[model samples]
Target: MADKSTNNIELKVLVDKESNKVIFIEPENDFVDVLFSFMTIPMGTIIRLARKHSDPVVIGCMNNLYASVENIDEQKFWIDICKDMLLHPCNAADHHCNLLKLKLDDAEPRRYFMCWYTSSCKFLSYDRNTSSPCHGGVMDREKSLRLDPSQVGNVFVKGEIRFTVTDDLQVIPPIASTNYVFTKLDVMDVDATEELTINIGTVEMLNLLMTSLVSKTPLTETLLKPKQEPKLSSSKIINQAIHIESQMFGDPMDGDEEGKISVKLVVSKSKKMVCYAEAGEDFVSLLFSFLTLPLGFILKNMKDGSLRGCISHLYKTIRDLDGQYMISNHHNEMILDPKLVPGFCYKNSLLGIEETSYYLVNNMLTTDRSLISTEPSQLKVIGKKDDSALGFLKGPAMFVVTDNLVVRPISRILELHILKDLNVPVTDIEDQIVHVGKKEALHLLLSSFLCDSVLTNTFVADLREPKQEQ
Candidate 1:
């Protein structure tokens, strides 16, 4: 068991002295559970936590997306809570994660709010100042979730079990012999290995998370040595662009016209690449909504290993594990097919992800009167009925989105400045309309994680001429 008093946990790692690489690590129940909990964290929460770390981990183009939300004015949103929801998205497995020995995510646990007037009020609000439909007072009273005691400590994997995790974040059962591991890895010399005990804390965990997204040998890059600058070769970028285009255009698209957002791409004719996109509020809202999705949900929707990251191995480890080794079938499902936090879904979202339904006992009152002793009744919280403002961003306005997804209000002067910065002649630029539906949204979500040239990789790949015979 890990020490509950401190943030650090001890892990035994096997390293290859010759290559200075981490071969694998044998983890305990607490450590394994904490690693598995990465799937439960929301993308926005990951970015937020990464920025707070001593060594910040920058995700591909997502940092710009997150900053766009931060730079936008509060009045641009329909309600203030809309912006807050994007900045601090709630995790679906918050209760399970809160029990982990090393708490990595700093986002506060979900707080429930109820109307103050009566115990029978049917409406519930995530925000404290939201008015109830029952003509009741402000929903400022906090209520605790009634969790089952038996399920309190029921985390990801079972206890007292031996497990082996590879450097790429692959979790597997105990191997038969160390000789076999070395043989499988093609390491012939047994003398070229060393064993070390690592003290993992919040900082190490954050580094691991960052490395898992970009590096194949995450453990070595995180624990054994400092991370080097990432290099994307031209051939590799072309291959990645081709792969992304195939995934984006090969799939059968949804035929729903209402769900499509029209975006005008500003292309550089000489380069045959997308310079930027001009879109309305709905398009920007859809892009901002990506941060609200849970990591598990994103992985589940992406084409297998489409997003370049070692975290997919961790996700597959959870998905392919035996049911008996997990706390419950529900726990396994929570990690494999996680949902969004309640009220985090936007109406304009093309991904078709649904928010989890929350049920509460409507017996808590906020007034100074005598406490009611009536029997508690479990009722489903009433969902928002009005669609006056279906998203975070205020509509009837235009916005500019760069290739790497830097969003800002559209300005003629700014557009001209961007053209000047690109140093492209005005005649060489052309406008083309692109329709983004469920298929394109999924494509963007996957590309935003793996590549810096999201628009070029997703939309402009087909326009480029093929390489000539060398």
Candidate 2:
């Protein structure tokens, strides 16, 4: 009866204290069945069980039996085995814990060990010289733990541990989504009225217009100078009044359909000055377009009465001819003949004339010449003398010469007519002639041409008589 009872026990594994190796196990034992049952047990539970019993525990599977120890001397070996088992659970068919064949001359003491199966059993003893395969599949739980001293207060407990979950052992909260709203409001009650009165001379207006045309900067920025008292006489000053009014008819909160905006602008001249004014947004935009015109073109147009009547008054008021004169002689010492009087002359000097001396052959002028002698040599001598005399006579002849003139090529008669009509001083014309000679002729031509065109297009009767409404 005792033998039968002993036979029911599957295996007996004996460990040598000195060698720390599994020394013996029954051949026909049921140790493999006992080890296979441990395959389903959690590694943590197995570790706790091993820690409770000081003695070595014999486990077996698939005709293999091995002993586990919690020896202080082999603590690292047991810990490594436990970590491997936790990372890779052993299968019933392939067990990682196995008893190694004992050798007589082995220098190091052998230690019984067990680990999660990889391809074959890998003992955890230091002398086994075998690498653990669970490293590839092992979860780095230490890295996920918030165990740093700095993270002690920051660590948060998210939720209660759940054991019924099949897919996820650890749960992480998802980041929250956000939505934003933007709003814009419009003014509904507007009752604004503004009136501005500006009194500027034509010269100041011209300066401002010129600055706007020539500079890329805005007009407001260029006109940011300190206010100065009017230097021009009241007669030359132009009074401009600007009145602007804006009103809102309905509340904006009611919707865009209910809200209505009304704007009004009035630009007029005062009773003192006859100023030309334009109002409304379209006229203002058109005025702004004038700034894009070329500076030379703007100056040229200013001379014309088409832009503003004040410009003409300004021109007459500033016109002065203190010192001016016309050239009488050319550098080549050629003089105008007394018999041919020039139509236009300033200070007793012809308007346009150039002097030059050149010899001319008689054949070019006439086919035949009557020489005093009939002899070939004598006739040749006479012809040469005649040619020399003709050249000398032609040298100083005034035939309405136009090239290389001291005065500009513009019609002197026309300028005289305009100046007389404008009531400009004769001396002012002379000064203008001098100024033209000093500066570029093209600059003078631009002003003169624009003025002539404007004057020609303008009605003479209208200029002479005031309008019935005015």
Off by over 4 Å in 1: 1-5, 53-55, 115-122, 127-142, 146-154, 174-190, 228-256, 306-308, 360-388, 461-470
lDDT string, candidate 2, 59-174, tens digits: 11100101111211123222233323222222111111121111101122212222334223221222232333444332111111112122121111112211110000011112
Question: Could you estimate the TM-score for every candidate?
Answer: 0.83, 0.12
Best candidate, TM-score-wise? 1
Off by over 4 Å in 2: 1-280, 304-470
Positional deviation of 337 in candidate 2, in angstroms? Answer: 38
Q: What's the CA error at residue 368 for candidate 2, in Å? A: 51
List all candidate RMSDs to the true structure. 5.9, 54.8
Superposed by TM-score, candidate 2 places the C-alpha of residue 119 at a distance from the truth, in angstroms, of 75
lDDT of model 2 at residue 106?
A: 13
Query: Which lDDT tens digits does candidate 1 get at residues 1-470?
Result: 23345678788998999889998898888888888888878899988987865656667677789999999898888777778878888887786788887888776776677776545666666667677778656778877654433454446776577788889998876644867766766667768888999887776776788778767888898788866524322233332322323322234544645668888889898977777889998888888988988888777765354334578788877677755677666567667777776567766677888765544434532211112244434333443423446677877889989888999999877778777888877899999777787777877876676557778767775633222212
